[model samples]
Target: MFSKIDLKSDRFVVVFINDILIYSLDEYEHAEHLRIMLQTLRDNKCEFWLREVGFLGHIVLTNGIQVDPSKIFAVVN
Candidate 1:
């Protein structure tokens, strides 16, 4: 499904089932990358929940991806 999108840049994009994580080193490229991703999803007739989406129990933010400490604890213990 992701093959349809051109992701050959320095940015990172990871897709899993209904979740997608788009990252870039800077803001301008990140916006462009996000636009491409959203367009692709719309073209494919896929619906996404913005508030519910996360990658491997981690949240993607401008600073970086953050994992829930509880989830890490569970894995460790």
Candidate 2:
């Protein structure tokens, strides 16, 4: 559904699946560009947590980093 877009300017993209960061790239940045990229992932049955989307290299959590015991264990194993 999505194809790589070659642009004449510098842009960056970071895509994640199910709260786990997966892809990073430098390319075009536009609504359609993001849409197509997301649609392509959906078409391939990739899952995402819409509420968890955030900046690259950072994890999304309530009240900042999750330090609870249960949540920590669940994430680690």
Question: Which candidate has the highest TM-score of all?
Answer: 1
Q: List candidate 1 stretches off by more than 4 Å.
A: 1-11, 43-53, 64-66, 70-77
lDDT values, one for every candidate = 0.61, 0.41
lDDT of 1 by residue, 1-77 (tens): 55664363335776666556666666687668777777666646543334433568776555566886667896788
Per-residue lDDT tens digits of candidate 2, residues 1-77? 22232231134344333432333222333444456556445545644433343544444453354344544576788
User: What number of backbone clashes does candidate 1 have, counting pairs of residues 3 or more apart or in separate chains?
Assistant: 0
TM-score of each: 0.52, 0.27
Could you tell me how far off, in angstroms, the CA of residue 24 lies in candidate 1 after the best superposition? 0.6
